[model samples]
Target chain A: MARAATTSDVFNAVAEPRRREILTLLVVGELEVGAIVTALRLDQPSVSKHLRVLRETGLVHMRRNGRHKLYRTNAPALQPVHEWVSTFERYWSNQLSRIKERAEAKMKQSRETGTSEKES
Target chain B: MARAATTSDVFNAVAEPRRREILTLLVVGELEVGAIVTALRLDQPSVSKHLRVLRETGLVHMRRNGRHKLYRTNAPALQPVHEWVSTFERYWSNQLSRIKERAEAKMKQSRETGTSEKES
Candidate 1:
């Protein structure tokens, strides 16, 4: 089947935990199908199915190495996904900054009151 | 049905483009279901289905406002997703940096050669 060509396809493919785990594995380096199946503790067919989805999403690239098919992360294909999710970063970033500010305020209060409670 | 309680669930729910669009709409502020449906140009049932998925994933919060249920983005629920995808930022960031460097180099070469070609 032709690979997915939209944001939904990319997100849907990665929606499976197994697929995310596969991507993580590829992030470190390329691996043969056997290693991926073993790492995920899933049956060969199940792993293959997830790999097919990943391949369709362009999140992974597969190459035949002799008799084995090796899978690697297609870093470029992930750029769009990364960019898309980045729009939400401001929300998280604002929350994180708020958290930091609260922590700093607490620390300042502790310093003023001579309390030894550690503020994280 | 009870909401999903894993990373997979969140990713799966947001995987739909309609769901993401809903999120974008909610980001600015909360909206009534009718408004969302109209904005997306989808039927009420379809929009409702997407909303259910979003609500199940905890990416959206709905409250009854009079006879209508207003939907809004659950900012905290999206934190994990944002953090998860941010890991891949380094890959795109590196690529962007590489592109910038190449552009700079090309610009320098153009200057040296007295060419006026713009490099982006």
Candidate 2:
């Protein structure tokens, strides 16, 4: 068994890329520490450290299953991060929508032209 | 002027709370380093350090305005973060709507009950 990490806030806890990888892995389902280590191909100590950080930050929930400790992401705990990032979403969403609309229009025009040529 | 920070990815750069605060302050408009210092109520060097990090990460754009350096957020750079967080949106969005629907139904039920009592 590994010692748990001291408390960390969401922002500080997720600073490392490895931690993010751990999160993406956990999003699908729960896994034991060894399973997580295998999934991420990380060493035991480093994975343990990141898990501790995520646990302390409330980003992940842990439970004891007899011998192994199972870990799973608590998605709602990321609301603050989601809210913060959302502030700037308006800037990109409009541009992306415009880009999508243009692509759709072009595709529709090409399809229409193709059909007309086929008929001719 | 302070030296710029080395390049950082969005996740790592935003890990610091002060940096997020600095980002919020810059979201509205550009500001000089001194103005940021005053806005955040942080010391000159700490503000400079964060600015450097943001600049290096490409999360912020720095321009020269006479003698002062102007800083503004590059919102599109956060697309990756936005996309990553959005993955979990489905979980919350549905849950929130269900909660709202329940609350609204309760209010409607109470109104109907009140009207019936009044008629009786």
Candidate 3:
């Protein structure tokens, strides 16, 4: 199957660690391209390239402030990614393991005392 | 910078839509390679390749079941991804918008009635 273009898909665009870092930085508030480059310690061209992919995928919004360009995260664009990953939340939550541990401990105590646990 | 290998990173492993589909199917329960191939309607080799990547990334676990290999999701491995994406939850949540809407409506009502609202 053909791969989705990284510039066109939010998931693909965010797959790069640098791009993820950029999004995290923008979350603090909007920043100029030069600010992002300085904060991330990356070269101008590389940052610009990532910004373009993020802009294309709608992960970040850009605006002009006179002579400068400001960028901020368009966080709503990440909702689909968040929702899809959240579906597996139950599988990873510690609550299930905690419950299992309590049950096993109770069972062990009952076995040692030879007493049946009363149903609640 | 060099890219992380898909076989080693959960995020990259799931970037492919087909792999994401496979993981969703595994969430139902463990399935054999043949079962996954049939359920996903992909070629055997393609399914096998995807399964290998999933296993290497620890997104899925495979165990021998006599003549077959059974696969199940290693959902705990997805915690990092869930945690990372969840940081942006507040940005997309409707609660903020709802609160803003209510405040705006109240302000509009107060203006129309020519009265100040009492502080709660």
Candidate 4:
């Protein structure tokens, strides 16, 4: 199968772990490329490439500050991704609640058995 | 750069729109391949391929029912993706709050000006 272009959409762009890390770092605030490189311990060119994909996909915003370019996450771009994943949230939550109910039932059964034994 | 394998991780596996559609469809309940093909309007081979990636990445679970195979979403596999994207939730929420504040301020100013005009 032909691979989809990473820069084509928010989901594709964020699929790369490096790009996600870059976006995570930017969430704190805008940072220059050099600062990103140092923070992630990645080389400058790799960081630039990831940032370019992110910028093109509208996942991050870049602005010029004199000779430097600063980047920050365009959080709204991630809304679609978040909303998509959130729909499945109920499945996990249901599993959790079921486990909680089982634990409570076991505790109650043990308490009732102890009381019956004491009465006998 | 060499493209990462889509089957390598949940993130890459879900980067494809078709695969996301397949997962969404499976969320309601387990379904066989033919049902998925009919619902998504995708050819059997293409749907099978996407399901393979989802299965390999543990995003979906497969089981045999007679001669047919059933598929369902392994929602917990998506926990990492959900957690990562959820961190950016505050950015959009903050923007919403800021917009709300501006509208409220505008309304208060209009009310105050209207009262002053009436008094004069």
Question: Which residue pairs in candidate 2 collide?
Answer: none
Q: What is the lDDT of residue B93 in candidate 1?
A: 68
Candidate 1 chain A: worst-modelled 10 consecutive residues by lDDT: A1-10
Q: For residues B28-101, could you state the per-residue lDDT of candidate 3 as single tens digits?
A: 79999999999989999999999999999999999999999999988887888888899988887866788889
Winner on DockQ (2 vs 4) = 4
Q: Which pairs clash in model 3? A: none
**lDDT for each residue of candidate 4 in B33-117, tens digit (9 for 90 to 100):** 9999999999999999999999999999999999999999999999888999899998897787888887777778778775322
Local error of candidate 1 at residue B105 (angstroms): 20
Task: Tell me how much of the true interface, by contacts, candidate 4 captures.
Answer: 0.73
Best model number under lDDT: 4
Tell me which of candidates 2 and 3 scores higher on lDDT: 3
Candidate 2 clash figure, as a count: 0
Q: Taking the tens digit of each residue's C-alpha lDDT, what string does model 2 give over B1-120?
A: 221223557876776778888888887899999999998899999999888889888889999989999999888888888788888777567789988897777778778776432221
Top candidate, metric DockQ: 4
As for lDDT, the candidate ahead, 2 or 4, is 4
Per-residue lDDT, model 4, residue A11, is 87
> Candidate 1 iRMS, in Å?
4.1
- Stretches of candidate 3 off by over 4 Å are A94-120, B94-120
In candidate 1, stretches whose alpha carbon ends up further than 4 angstroms from where it belongs are A1-8, A105-120, B1-8, B95-120
Quote the true-contact fraction of every model: 0.60, 0.69, 0.62, 0.73
